[model samples]
Target chain A: MQLTGGQILCESLIREGVDVVFGLPGGAILPLYGTLPQYKDRIRHILVRHEQGAAMAADGYARATGKVGVCWATSGPGATNLVTGLACSSMDSVPIVAITGQVARPTIGKDAFQEIDVTGVTLPITKHNYLVMHASEIARTIREAFYIASSGRPGVVLVDIPRDVFQEKAEFGEYPTTVDLPGYKPVLDGNISQILRAARLIKEAQRPVVLAGHGVLLSRAMDELREFAEKTQTPVITTLLGLSGFPQTHYLSLGMPGMHGVAWASLALDEADLIIGLGARFDDRVTGDLKRFAPNAKIIHVDVDPSEIGKSVATAVPIVGDLKRVLKQLIANVEPAIHVEWMAHLDQLRREHPSLYIRPTEKLLPQYVIREISEVTDGRAVIVTGVGQHQMWTALHYTFKEPYTMITSGGLGAMGFEVPAAMGAQVGVPDRVVWSIAGDGGFQMTMSELATIAENNIPVKFAIINNNFLGMVRQWQEFFYNREYSASGYTKNPDFVKLAEAFGILGLRVTERSQVRDAIIKAMEWAGPVVVDFVVEEEENVYPMIPAGTSVDQLIEEPQMVEERR
Target chain B: MPKGPASHTIVALVQDRPGVLNRVASMFRRRGYNIVSLSVGHSEQPGFSRMTFVVNGDDHTIEQVRNQLDRLIDVVKVSDLSDENVVARELALIKVQATPYNRSEIIQLVDIFRANIVDVSPDSLIIEVTGDEDKVDSLLQLLKSFGVRELMRTGRVAMLRGANAYPGTPSANGNQ
Candidate 1:
């Protein structure tokens, strides 16, 4: 079919099974917008107030649906604005395709108005990129972009299309829409010998532990991981990124093991005889004082990316394959071994150093707010969170029973992610409840997305933990920087309830702890999006922090004691 | 570990340009990969060059050096030819001081190895030998006995067996 570049792009996206697009239109993308009306029924276009929100929305959609989320933007600032969100996606291994409109071909390289070298800027961040100078290449480039975005070690892919190309007519043929990367094969089947050796190690070890990471969720191998753990009676320790790999309520499940992780979980890692790492990178945060991390364990690392296997901690048995496939193979080959003594030891430690949560008093506690919200929603709603105190509280308190039910910026720790991401998640699963748990500081960063929520009528509930400070940074300053509070505290701030009301959305403010549940219920009952600002106690810190360069055993249990009393 | 004189195969895909071969050889000279034999040629794709080299070192150590070379970003892909399926050939211009007695011996040796005398200037013979790395090394050893004056050998160029599949091809979207 002979069609314009814009029409070709739309057709190719349709063929790729793209049902939704999150973006804002500009002059450079006017041609593409011109063709959007015809395909409105096939593609639901969610117009965001800012380009940043659009990119983050796409990120949220990708994280939730495991599909290559697509977003479009115009030239210059429009393309540059998507950089933060794209970097966030790249860091988190989210598959996103960002399409940006460029100035006319003739005006390129001449310092044309509203023009920027987006491809050059995004090279380091994206998996691959293309600049479509010719209109004929539009369909092929879009197809390739989606393919690249969703492939091995998935990341963002960008396609910069000039405005002139979009306006031009071209012979658009349905080219084979598949990528053939010879050097990009992700090994899914592990070597049988290696698996047997690892299984033998597991069986012979006195105290073995399974340290599962995000890879288990990515491979959808939670069932296999659970079976292996239960059959062998080995306790499971998860990294921060691997939080949802196992249910926190499970008998063998030791929650997140690292800085800010429970003391018992970190100690269990130190005491294990054999450490089985699945799809988890040994980040410095996770392996505090690397020299002492899991010193007694013979590490067995299984990951899809070969580079990650022996990059940080050396592995005794390195299985380079998909975690899901490899776990299934191990379960089939290895006989279950009883570790009754080990289970008893872990249980004793759990009882000794339990995960302690203080009940809410007259002033609202963030942990109580998250727990109440989780209970009220029946643990079925998709919860998104921004980084800092609220994010940690959500991870530590909220119990997510299903995979992908909780989406947060785990790798990048980008502020202002939750609200826009929740908006995107709501778009992806409209009937399901979606909540954005955010800190006051992080919430205000991209709170403009409230307009996006109101405009689109997205029924997203926002729970703002309003402690008038950058809680995480302030915690660090309080403990590590002699309690010298710089610009961390926000003495003056806009009333979130008024702000939400001004955006034509429902709003609720809960100052006292007793009002939390009622406020949340009222906000959730709103026809459109609603924001609930819960006034939390200031100077609250996430405990069990392993100070820098210290071993996991040397954790600061109570920050106040470490800072002042000690 | 004690190092052994093991053979090393260095394959490089370079941008086709003037003096690129000289620049690469100088790099080898500075870094110390004992080049036993070398070959170079234009690839199937235009304006791109492929070069191969045979060096003497431990296989693992040589692979580590090749990994460093591969990190150069300009050098597309590097493979140890010792373990890979490859075709290696070299062209050496040997300006040996040939006399009447030694002339027949050199000619006979060239004929045995299927090497062609592309240029015979009465005083010297430019022999082009196309074969595996061992064959090239043998020819070079035999030519050295003739008191060679000047030698120019093209490095190796190789493609994997069975198919010509490039990385990041459009059809590589099967997993997705």
Candidate 2:
């Protein structure tokens, strides 16, 4: 049937099962906005305040639903505004498709008003990009963009349509024109030789530990990981990104292992004889000193991305394939073994220094607040967190049993990611409880998304650990920079409760430590979105920090007093 | 440094867009691939272009060239033409100072090389020649004695003889 490029785009999106699109109208995109009304029943268009927020919302949607999130923007500045969100998605491997309208084809190189080379600008950050000057190519290009975005090691894809092309009439076709990419084959089967070698190492090792990462969650291999761990009786230490892979309450689960990871987990990683890595790249935070990280372990690295296998740490056996497939093979091939002595040692360490949270009777701690919230939500809620002390606290205190339930910007560590991400998560999974746990500083950055919650009536709960400062930066300055207190204190800030109420959402504030539980319960009880601001201690720092260039054994057990206070 | 002579040929496909050629050449320069000659033009498809680059290198150096070119995002496919293809040609335009004493001699050499005199001024004659890269180099070397005034050369462009194979060719995969 004959249709305009813009109409074809909307129709193709519907065919691809797209339910929503986040965007704003502009001069170059008028044709698309004009055609959007016809497909209004099939596609829900959300108008975001800014293009950056739109892109991030798409990212959040993709992360939560495992689908390619779609966002649209106009020409020039609007297209450029999606750059940060695109980069964030690219870094974190979130599947997103960003469509932008361009100036007419005739005016492309003449520097027409509101015209920028968006395809060129986004080239480096996208999986692939296309500039469709022909109306007939619109459906196909959008299809290709979605395919590229959602396939393999997923990332953002872009399609630029000229304004004139969007207005031109053409024969429309269903999306996914064709699936032919000769050069883009993703390896799914594990290399048998490497798997056998890994099994041999596992069989020989006296004390072995499994290190799971975000790849496991991305591959949805939680069941295989659990079976593999149980079969081998291997203790599993997860990176911050791998927090939700194994149930936090599991006896074999040695929680987050990194610079701010649990003391026992890091120590166990350091002492293991065999280290089987699943889906986790050894970031600097995880491997404080590469030379000292798992110094004595024979490493078996399994990851979907081949480049990640030996990029950071040397692997004795490198299995490049989907983690889920590889883990299942390992579980099937290897005989079950019991490391009674190793488990005893780990149990002793766990007993000695557990993940401790001091529940002060007078002042509220963020850890206590997180634990109470987790209990109140019944561990079924999806928790999104902003970066810093509160992020670490949530990682430590909350027990995430399901994959995609803890959706935060782990790779990017992007501040202000939680609120918008939580909103997107709530939209994706309407029935599930969603929580945005943020520090004071992160909450203020994208607090505008609070309006999104109110407008959509998404029942996402916001918990702001209001320490009245940029807590993470302040902690670093306090510990590493001799407490110079350079721009770390937030002496003047708005009342978040009032800010929430202004956005037409329920608001609550908790000052006394005793009010934390009741306040969280009340926030969750509100029908729509609600915000609870907890005034946490200003100087509380994340403990068990493995100082730069130091081994896990050299971690600071407790916060050190500033040698010279400024 | 062999100190004698070494050369290599590479063919690459890139998206048909402005600044793409410059990006490819600049990448070669940045990565230390010595280009002896380079050619670029539209390919079999409308929105795709092909580039052929000849560099002075030995086996090891040629391997490095292939590896470096593979890393460039704009370079869709890279093939070493030296080992795989036959039909290699470079176009050269040479302007020689043609005094009365040497004009006929230069013309005779041009005819022997099957080169055409495209332009002639009172003082200089411009000869255009298209042949295998070696033939073009030979002609240039012979013309140098007559006091060559100006020279412009296109990089070697090559195609395989009788379709033994090209990397991205449909026949190479036997899928078509």
Candidate 3:
């Protein structure tokens, strides 16, 4: 049967098992939107307030469901607005397919009203992209796009279709069952010799630390990672995005390691004899000073993407393949051994610089709010966050015991990511409780999505860590710029509780430390979406920070000088 | 060849599709990899194009470039021919200003370099030279004394010396 390009698009989406898509409709995409009613039972289209929200919601959906997420946008500004969201997913290796509408073929380069070179703009930020030339190629292109997005190291892929193509006719049959790209093959099994070499390193090392990254969660290698850590009795240090890949409550688990990582975890890395990096690139934030990072350790890097291995840190043994398969081979080859002295050393360091110490203060501290949420949720809620002091606080304070429990903007550190991402996660996994923890500065950036949440009744609990300033930047200014305060302070901020009420969502405000727990409990108990304004102390800073490019040894444990400010 | 930055040649077979070149060039630029020279043309396969790139980097940078290039969906195969015993050549056209006083000397120098005069004007000669980069540079340096007007060079193109790396039937190029 002959089908219009719009019908083919809906058909191909259903064929790819896509049940939900976050998008906004405009003039260029109206043809496709008009055909949505035909497949409304199979596909649910969520009308987003902004294209960026659509992109980030797709990212959150992918992270929560471990399946490819889909989003849509019209031409020009709609496509341009998705750039930051695309970069965020690209950096974090989230699998998302973003489809954009283009001007009709004849008017493409004539500077048409809403035309943009979307594929060109997204070239550097996407895993791959394609501009569909004909309606006949839509099915095959969508198939390849989804395959390329989710295959090895998941990433974002965009497909741009001309507006006229949506109205064109194509003879449709079955969607392509296979991808025929020759260069797109992903290596799954690692070299046996390299696995043996890594095993040898593991058996010989006395002080070994397992550094797990987001790849572990992406590849679903949590069990293999846990087994290897247990069999070797090695302590595991998770990167920020890798938080839930290993159980934080486990004795061998060290919370996070990096610039703002736990002091003890950074110290453990400093003194290790062997570092086994699983699916984690040694990013600048994670390594601090590359020259001084893991100076005494021999690194064995394992990753599915060959480009990521030795991209930052030098590798003594590099295994290029899936983390799950590589870990299984390593488990089979390596013998179990105990490292009592190493664990004891880490314990001593942890005791000397308690990772979770909170000063007894009557002021409503952000840390207290995060800790209270963690306690109330029993560490099982799917926690999403925007970038800032609140993000770091969530990473440090939340005790994650399950995989895919923590989703945040890691590589890009894009602010305003929490609101829509939380909505996406709640939609992806409706049975799980989802929370959007945001800093005051970051929350205001995308709070427009509150209307989208209310419309959909997304059931995401929002926790605004309202410190009335960009807390991270303010902390840096205090430490380095002599407390200039500059533009980081929010002098005239809108009341978040009142804003929530305006959006017709339940609202609560917590000013005192005692109200934090009750507000969180009340939000969680409510069935639909609720927003809690957590008025935290303005001057609180994330501690144990290895300032920018400094080594772990120069970690600032606490404030050095008390400034006299009212 | 030293421990610091060195030049490496990479060859890629890619689909003869629009924007493939843009994709390859964009990846190099985005990753901050330095490109010394690049040449591309239709390959033996009807649907494929061959691209040869001379990149300047150390071992890690070169590996990253090759990995990133191969990661492109349109790129079929990527190989580093820097270390192989291959036949590499570059072609250049030199338009040198020639006066009656130095015309004979310039012709003599071109003869010695085995270059042919492709075009001639009353006061200028365009010499076509095909050889390695060093040979082209040597001839360009000699003609510079005669006031070289303009020059154009096609970057390096190379193939392995033996028959091992060739596609299709063995000894297709009669090298075996």
Give RMSD to native, each candidate: 7.6, 5.5, 3.4
Cα lDDT of model 2 by residue, A461-552, tens digit: 99999999899898888777878789988888898889999999988999888898888888777789999889988888787677778887
CA-lDDT, candidates in order: 0.79, 0.81, 0.90
> How much lDDT does candidate 1 score?
0.79
For the record, the alpha-carbon RMSD of candidate 2 to the native fold, in angstroms, is 5.5
lDDT tens string, model 1, B12-128?
666564445655565466466668767777777787777767778874447445643442323555556565665545555656667767788888999999987777776677777
True contacts kept of 1: 0.00
**Chain B of candidate 3 versus the native chain B: what TM-score?**
0.91
Each prediction's TM-score against the native? Answer: 0.81, 0.83, 0.97
Report the lDDT of model 2 for residue A564: 24
Worst 10 residues of 1 chain A by lDDT: A177-186
Q: Return whichever of 2 and 3 wins on TM-score.
A: 3
* Clashing residue pairs, backbone N/CA/C < 3 A, model 2: B37-B155, B38-B155
Question: What is the Cα-based TM-score of model 1?
Answer: 0.81
Which model, 1 or 2, shows the larger DockQ?
A: 2
Q: Rank the candidates by DockQ, best first.
A: 3, 2, 1
- Per-model i-RMS: 9.6, 8.1, 9.0
Candidate 3, residue A352: Cα displacement in angstroms equals 1.3
